[model samples]
Target: MNKVLCFDLDGTLINDKNEIIGGEGTIHALKKLQNIGYKLVVSTGRLEHDIYYINNRYDLKLNYAISQNGAVINKNKELNAKLLDKDEALNIYEYLKTTDLRVELNTVSNRYWHTDRDPDFPKEYYDSSNIVHDFRNVIEYQPAVLFLVIGESDKIKVVQEHINSNYNKVKAIRTSDSSLEILSEGISKGNTVVELFPNSEIISIGDSENDFSMFELSKKSYYVGKGSCNKATYNFSSIYEALKQIIKGEENGQ
Candidate 1:
């Protein structure tokens, strides 16, 4: 049977600065994996447009791309999207408007958010994509993924609970103490992978709480750093070491 390796992109693959950390030797490792006939998939919370921008900005490549926490899927450069209803989208906007958090709304075609004054959010992303400045100006019933960055932990928790209780159609994950990511229900990296490759053996790697759903669904899941809360089967200090081990036969397609 064929095997698949799913990777989480943000905290796991790239840091906030958008550099591929610990990847100086990754291409060789990845080539070896490809030679051994393993399929590679890029799983990320970023929507399609940001993924495309980042791929080009960083010179990245992938066989398949899962974006928006699996709300969108791309294979062979063809894209498919599952959108959030306008009503639900409005609910999300209203729920988040109370906080000082910088919210970024990402669709398959464009991303919407406040201007670059907020230093916490990546201005580079805002500069590269089509951005809708006002909610009234947003297109009708467009599919979007929202990224909320900055807020006190307790406040963010309350916000998440409110989203869960009031907006059952949407789900939020606290990717970090100050960041909460909202995605359409029934869409997650793990669920998407299962749907796409129902019969394949899977291996996964990640470094944050946003990755927990995918970790829970993998045959073997490895945490990328210490102090990770998710119950990974093993822990690796970096992605490079994990890939190198696979290349050196430390772990085969078991």
Candidate 2:
């Protein structure tokens, strides 16, 4: 059976500025784990290209990339995806239109935003790579997920409750104070990981609520940094420290 180590990208592996926290040490530890026959997986809410970008930029050489929470997965070179029902997506679009929230549709490679543009978000998301579409027209893409950016922290819970209560076809998870993730019901990081590697002994490392699913499936779960995840088996300061502990666990036959 295979041994897998899945990591959540943002706060777990990289910092706020997108820099690898442990730098060379983190890379070395990952390489060592792979050398010992462990499969490395990056389980994140990021897009596919961003996964490749991290591997290329950091030399992480991950064996699998679970993108968009769990809507898409790249196992080695093969792609597997589960898209939102277009009608359900449109239903959400209509509901979100009633609010002042900044909305965007996320495909495996691109993010489509309304052409009217809300200045609530940073210029980074409105970059040249992502598409600009009029949400009033159609659900332009078969999105893997929808990002609803509610800039106000107070309204975040209210919006999440509204979506979860009204939508049976989709579920909304509060990924951050300003953001909520909407994906098809029953899809999650844990389900996807177990589906793909059913016989493997898994370990999860993350720092947020979305990572909770992964944590639930792990043989050992590590919650890094300060993000809220009470389900983790342990907590660590940095990825390097966590990786080292994982190595130590193996050495001690844990």
Candidate 3:
């Protein structure tokens, strides 16, 4: 099997509005990468429903996707083949309720959230997720990822400390100054790629702090936009530009 070129969905593959800015040529870039013996993998924090929804709407034609920040992996056209344990998810959910943060809990089939007292939440979130009215059934639902949005850096540290002290089998990473993502230990988009393709040369592409893990693990990395990520081999303004650079290198017999 060929090595993979992993892509982060939002900001890397498309805009916040779920649009790829370069138009149809971007699709051609993906196909060209495939023609050049690379398998394209869409890696994102989105649920399966939203990933499929965006791909169909945008015609991205994704073959593989690592969803929920790598809490789940879909390969060979199968969906959600790997998932986190439900009891561990309940542990996260129950403890987070005591803290002052908004949480988005995800499973393969559904998404539940708690946005209490969070007035700054985007309107799209209001329409996208189900409010967690009943948590009695959370464990039975088998969550794949737990995303918490904290208002301050202190709260982010608090959660990080809590995970370190109590749930050493899980991990808490700061996706942003105000956002923390929780998942099983070693469950990251980069780790997933390493686990699935242990000997492959992986090229990871992303644009944010959430993407740092992949950059660290990739054979080479193309970071989109200007930000700090450990071990990014190159930087590009957009996916189209990155693809063109790689294709051009191939044409020169590099």
> Which candidate gets the maximum TM-score versus the true structure?
2
| Error in Å for residue 221 of model 1 | 0.9
TM-score for candidate 2: 0.90
Residue 117 CA displacement from its true place in model 1, Å: 5.0
lDDT of 1 by residue, 118-182 (tens): 56554445354554566544635555555455568888888788887887777888777777777
Q: Is candidate 2 or candidate 3 better by TM-score?
A: 2
Worst 10 residues of 1 by lDDT: 122-131
- In order, candidate lDDTs are 0.72, 0.79, 0.73
Candidate 2 clashing pairs? none
Q: Give a tens-digit lDDT track for model 2, residues 88-152.
A: 77878777777877777776666766654555433332243444555534355444455555557
User: What's the residue-level lDDT of 158 in candidate 1?
Assistant: 84
Q: How do these models rank on lDDT, best leading?
A: 2, 3, 1
Error of 1 at 110 (Å): 1.6
Runs in model 2 with CA error above 4 Å?
Answer: 115-128, 131-133, 136-144
Question: For each candidate, C-alpha RMSD in Å?
Answer: 2.6, 2.7, 3.0
